[model samples]
Target: MKFERLPFIMKNLIRYQATMKENDWNKGFDLLRSIEFQEGVYKTGPMFFSMEPAENEPRYRNFEFFMPVNFQVEGE
Candidate 1:
């Protein structure tokens, strides 16, 4: 395996969050892609995703998906 360290830079992000059933990860990416295409936003870097146990639902997970963009996104 190969590993490389990346530096942190402050940038705009288009994010989506939801509590979803286990293994439903791809949907967030699809949603973000749709938003990107519709908004004509330039993607500045790689997408980022994180998951944790849902706060109130044990069988589901809280997922956060972030896409770094060149311009600020207007909505939440």
Candidate 2:
């Protein structure tokens, strides 16, 4: 499994990272909206998770939905 830290709702808050197969992209988005989360501050464009190219790794040349969210947390 892959693991990485998702952005926080605010400073010093819990964060989660998840991925969906993307059958219905809106479903994933709707689920996020139904949860207690907030929008993260970022440049208004595609944010690539880039690294030095590897012969065994594939590149993501396109994305239909790319967003970052933070779960609302009451404590640090």
Candidate 3:
């Protein structure tokens, strides 16, 4: 198999982090949308998601969700 590396592009994003089990993975996303709605923010690009084993809780994972916005949000 062959693969090519893609260059990293810098982006401004609103980030939300949470720890939860796989069954509740969408919770973070829902919360992020709620915040976006409350703040009148719109997504400008794809949503980014990352996860790793939660500290001291093997059943859960620490997740970070990122939403790229059209412009930088103040007081972030």
Candidate achieving the largest lDDT: 1
Candidate 1 lDDT, 11-55, residue by residue in tens: 898889988987888999989988888898878899989999988
- The model with the greater lDDT, 1 or 2, is 1
lDDT of 2 at 48: 26
- Give candidate 2 regions above 4 Å deviation: 1-21, 37-76
lDDT of each: 0.88, 0.36, 0.81
lDDT of 1 at 8: 76
TM-score of each: 0.82, 0.25, 0.79
- In candidate 3, position 56 carries an lDDT of 91
Count of clashing pairs, candidate 3: 0
lDDT of 3 by residue, 1-76 (tens): 9999999564668888888896788888887788777778888878778999998998999999888876777755
The digit string of per-residue lDDT tens for model 2 on 1-76 reads 9999997433323332333332433453454344433444332233222123334435412223334433333422
| lDDT at position 21, candidate 1 | 88
Provide the lDDT at 3 for model 2: 96
lDDT ranking, best first: 1, 3, 2
- lDDT at 65 for candidate 1? 93
Q: Locate the minimum summed-lDDT window of 10 residues in model 1.
A: 8-17
Minimal lDDT window, size 10, model 2: 42-51
